[model samples]
Target: MKMMYLRRLFTQELCPVTHTDLMGCLQHSPQQLQQLLSGGFAGAPGLESLSWLHNLAPCFPLRGDQIQVIHEPQHFYQTLMQRIRQAKKRVVLASLYLGTGQLENAFVQTLRHSLQAQSSLRLNVLLDFTRGTRGVANSKTMLLPLVREFGEQVQFSLYHTPDLRGMTKRLAPPRWNELLGLQHMKVYLFDDAVIISGANLSNDYFTNRQDRYILIEDKPLADFYAQLIERVQEFSLAVSADATEGLHRNWRILPYEGTKEQFIRLAKERVTNFVQEAYQRQLQRQELDTEADTWVFPLLEMGQIGIHHDSVVTKQLLSNCIAGSRLKLATGYFNLTQEYMDTITHKCLAQCSILMAHPNANGFQGAKGPAGGIPAAYTLIAKSFYESLVRRQQNHRVNFFEYQKPGWTYHAKGLWYYLPNARLPNLTLIGSSNFGERSVNRDLETQVCLVTDNMDLSQRLQAEADRLYDLSTTAERDIVQRQVPRWVQAVVRIFRNFF
Candidate 1:
């Protein structure tokens, strides 16, 4: 029965509409497209009225559920650990890479304790293979140890999307796919509750580095993520590590070199199925709350030409959020693709608040260095995004700001507010989607589209945004008009896609 449904879903191409088709509409009918664009993305022909929200909002099963925004890392950890402690049925952890540190060690211990306490509880962990296998000094070294400790009670799955192999590998640069492709989602699900953030399970993400953290209690949403984990597990390799001779760490899991094409196909299918299921579920619930209408949906985008270029649910949902509304965007990096540029600038909005990382605010990179160094180059590239907006005078419509605190890098990424004059935000985006070409065209990403009617949650979100804005310095025209070095500009244009 499952296979039959899967086949039918795959054949039908479950997206309501594709990005390419939208582009075609914009190209073929400029005057009509301009009218919709002026009204904002949410006001697109099919999505303009409030009735559209009613039609799509009922899919979420929770009512007046709790949704909290955690601005501080300590608070995020406290909430995360508390939920893990309370999870009785199952716990699933997924991240791009689990960095080794005091935080990592402490988390492992907590999980170990939880498993020991509950004999029947099940735990599953999914991580990227390339990142998992990479050697790091002072790493937590828990993967193999935990497997050894819990045996069958704990399961681990590692996603491996190898680069083009054999002759193709030789033709492309070694880091080509590394920069273009990889599983980059960060999700933590504990039974009926879930935590979505761009932060990985590491010290920086838990403490110093800034990122968005959203905690919501909803069984349907949690189950949706759990199902995603299961889909990934099917494609991921069941990894096991053992004591190895002469290895520095004394443990190793042999590498995997498989059919990259087949791996990508399975991964794309997983995303497609997830979208289809969410769409179908929404259709089943017709009487969604009208007074304080709030609906939740999962947005997955995998960068495989036909699959991603056309089926970017995140972009679509973002458009819906922006329809007839202003926008407040926060991201650590500020590199906008043409698509996003069109979406933000062309839309009819009273204002736009964009919070990003200044070169000095980049925790991973330093501002003072050789002009051609990695950190310097990336800083300059970020500035290019600013330059583009300024040159076009889009800066007037945007209150460009950056979070500032010495030594702490900013890594938050998502659209926070999607309304104009409301006391609180009605819609928000949370997860690993960055505002850049890589996130748009190359990474496996996941985020939750949180639509809610709770005034308290809205107030908390507003407070967080206000705090960041307070710390931020507005990017006036003069500040953005500074001349960048010709050399830096040239290099930025060359590597624009990679950022």
Candidate 2:
């Protein structure tokens, strides 16, 4: 009982939104909690002790293009092309893959157009070694020329863990040479906007296969990311270092590798640990709050539930207390950690609702294609994964809602837990993290956790959730009725857990 009150007190110590330092409304009266949640992210302090809250509100509310969630290939193509064409000042792009295909060719055209503009633009690209190489040839061919052509204006680098073949120790004496983990952050930070997403700098993110990208125009977010980029460059680390030295400091540069591969390796290891730890912390941060009738916790649980002192807890702790009731889940795939999946099944059986925004296909990287989007073969794999889930879990009582992507892809990563008030767990998680096995354990993903009573953002996200949940549905019966091959049926049963 006392633990609950202590948790509330700590929350009152730190504010989640507006980056203010309030834990949460700890000892505030019922009326105070009402007024507190009703307030903006960071605004007037609560009561007299919290009066300094004015300092938390910046000079502005982060703004952006307010991009409409899209699903079509043409729109995705046009958007990237436009981004390249309109860029001025500096263009910083980081993605997992930029394959060798016509899609890459078309993308090059846009980049070239930007270079030809002679706007003195600085383009910095950080690409993954795995995605850059299709196992046979180097993927760096796509951006190498720009780096050389633009000279002082344009720059590029490849991020790879060197000589990392087969399987080897990731931390044995810190070989620091073998590139095991790859940098998987898909972000486009320009002078005016910051875009953190799951889509890489490849055609698949835009075409028929299904993809999503979100643009956040908050200047502070952009500036924060930009500084991190500079830190990567200044400290020759991508291919083989720990982290960019003193990442938060501006105008600070430590020795950095001239090549991108070193930076990539270093960046991957650095983020890998971070994601693992974050998942753990988010789960256990909230203390029992029976008195106030609720608990508050960080979206990324640090590591309390982790298997080892270092092993991370990637399992999602589906909230059941009013918070998990009004849940909205958006992921590229339907598979979830065992714990989370069971939690949802239990909650639904008990009478809670769940909504999902899943891409058309579960995203199986298709065979090497001419255009590089997604081949029909890959789509088939995704289709099978969904069918198996429907057939197997019919008795779970969970309302599975699927979202459809419009002319563009919807790559927003979030889990809205609106409990009793639809705004209680109105805690929205936004970032580059994906729920898949590769994302949760292998790749380096970062996301922002925002817990707000802001009805405006919640409304927009909720409406979008509704639209998507009604769009995509591939039932198990549909697959069986279509007379899918026995071999395909067998594969679906065996691998549904993988999606």
Candidate 3:
């Protein structure tokens, strides 16, 4: 009943209220960013990247010391295994989901290997509760075995947003919707080095889903992620004695403990209030809007909604890459949004030559049913989207292809732009942000855009893009169901802004 009351206080059948109304204000996007970008960058920082989550840094840079584009899952997976094999003191894994079979076996082997080798090694894992409930429930079944196999060394929990579903359904007031839209972030940090990526342990995201990761060794970002993991650890401690919330609740696999009325109150009062504060102090001010006094043009855009709605940053990023003379190179989920297609098509006619790599099958390497290994719904969607892009580009003189390499995932997230005979290099932006709406705003995402004078990085990125643009194959958009025959394709298009 107490939990139910807390939840009631949060959501009311009322309209959403935002902290700031920035319509009249004219903010300038930062021009300096336009001049320092080179090569390409990509990342998908969800949930934790929320501008309103906890004590987030006012602004954080998404750049790394040595910018390496990893398109192979084995490269990233082996790298992580290597780290686990060498750990001396502690090993920590924070995840959203861990799928079935050998992938699952491989995950257990790596961590259990260390725990079995040494009795003193401490291993902690914090996972998401959203996917843990239904489906296969692999995460739930594996926990006891981990502890049973390694005993003192292995410890884990399926973390969840306290006021969400499952446990709340039976509670009074039934305020389970509070957990809607909650995100699952993938991170691993230990011994001064942090590995962040879009891939999860499941065969889907790593071997199945197209994904990427970066090994960061420096401060600020590393420190921030490390601290987030620490917070989860703290939550786990609370569950030991019974003060469950977020990470702690899931770690122990505890019940929702609170009532529906209790959850609603908390969602409205605590959750909404928390995000509002984050929006005002950090997101609004830190999101650079306009740019001036640089050879590169500032981003002029519309249809905005995010930290600062209708802001010019995203549009600027798009326009900057689209309005090019020689090259337009990028790699995404290959799902085309209508808005994205319109913008890219317009830019192509304006003289930008386009190229995209990433064979649709690579991300699903060694999978069982469908997207790649079998006949999955996404394959149909991918085919439809790719065909749409091809249709538009073919109508013009633009260069485009479906880059295929022996063992690569094509996970790079930045685009390349080459100007006429000018000596200037290309632009590169990296981070957990994508071309999708969820990436741009819905999910808390972070990105670093750099316009550098470095020709090597720019040239190399452009060359790689050319490799992607060279792939050309017809798609089969056949679907399993007729009603939603175009449903999946429709989703990919709508999500990317096509509608």
Candidate 4:
């Protein structure tokens, strides 16, 4: 009940009322609140001073870092390969799955050459067990060959996030737990440089699909990400080259502690401790990095919602939406939580635009058919969500868009917020997070919240935003409503949370 009250209070309904106007009752104006949060309200009086929640929030910012945004997959892959080859001391790579394909083979061959060239170099590859163990159609095992060659030269680990699905476990087939619960984060770190992306190491992601990419060259930031991998590695299982005993031995088999909720809470605590420690370490190292002029806040939402309950990314996003004077967001998927939807329709903003993937622009559209496959189903469901927003009473206040490009799939995801009277976005997020229920309540997500006072950086980000808007087609309500079949809308309504 207390939590429920807090949610309502934060909503800030603007309709004139008697005693129900919470903000009015508290004598707090939204403008004043925005001022308090424009630069992140930390160390303030009351609830702001609490360390437990403050540590989790992306409230603090780090400065003096060179940042670059990469969108072209071919260019991204080439740059990544270059970084891998140039590594000196250590290279840490983590992805949900290092997919099987020519792309994966290239990466493997590169690692081999790097190891041969430099004997002392350290390489650590972490992956989600459920995904890493799987093979593509008519392909050999993904990681085993690499493990065989590297042996103990390279470290291989699998993050097997415990599955306490209980009765729901029966709903899925064999290996259901693997599919349902996963470590969805994607990170790439090499020495003092890091490439943060939502894209997986696959040919499709490399050649056709589009995903947000941000490169930061700062050892302090690199150390933080590397440490995150190390901490997860501590909890993860180490894979071996032996196929016989390796399968059974690589996964950590922790017994059920209590309810799934209890176990998730414990896991959240562990993750939070690591994050707090990394943040403190970065703070200490910040003094030495003199070139960092832009502020970067690492945002993490690392657990299941009902079970673990650290919606740091979601909460911070909501705060930004309510606080920012203008907002621009791009996401491949269109599904949105009620809170987000409300924020979009209600924010006291001068301008707002949302870019989403068109039905044809879906990465899996080629695999989908009229009879309906996973890709077709998801696109249909997303259209329904888009329709809902189009029909909103405040729809006129926002502009909707879908990217248009032949033979290319849209996978971009990020948010940009402009402060009042500012020409460029003062705050932005870039990484693996998508704006949807799965990202908000289910998946393990990571994003770097970049807040900058540097005018040059803001101008560059504005140019990116302009390009995104320019490449998109303005979504018309009439056109969308006519295209989607009514039956699909019903289905979307029934299973809205998954998207």
Backbone Cα, N, C clashes tallied per candidate = 1, 50, 56, 3
User: Which digits, one per residue and each the tens of the lDDT, describe model 2 over residues 1-499?
Assistant: 2233223322223222331223342354454344335443333222222222222211123321232333345575676677778888767877776766788787877787887885687777766545564445345666666655666665454444333433343433231221234556666776767665566666666665444444655554565556545533432223222212232222222223243454444443343344333323322333322222111121221111111111121122243333224555566554454445545554332333333343343343232432122222223443444454466763343444444555444454456555443433344445555555434444445454444334455566566555555666734333333433455445545543333
Question: Candidate 3 regions off by >4 Å?
Answer: 1-67, 88-92, 113-124, 133-137, 143-184, 203-210, 229-316, 320-322, 325-400, 403-434, 437-499
TM-score of 1: 0.79
TM-score computed on alpha carbons, candidate 3: 0.54
Which should have the higher TM-score, number 2 or number 3? Answer: 2
> TM-score, each model?
0.79, 0.59, 0.54, 0.78
Full-model lDDT for every candidate? 0.62, 0.45, 0.43, 0.62
Q: In candidate 4, what are the lDDT values of residues 218-319, reduced to their tens digit?
A: 777788888777766755667677742232232243423235555455455456666555544432332232233465667665545222222444444445
Residue pairs that clash (backbone atoms under 3 angstroms), model 4: 64-292, 64-293, 65-292
Best by TM-score: 1
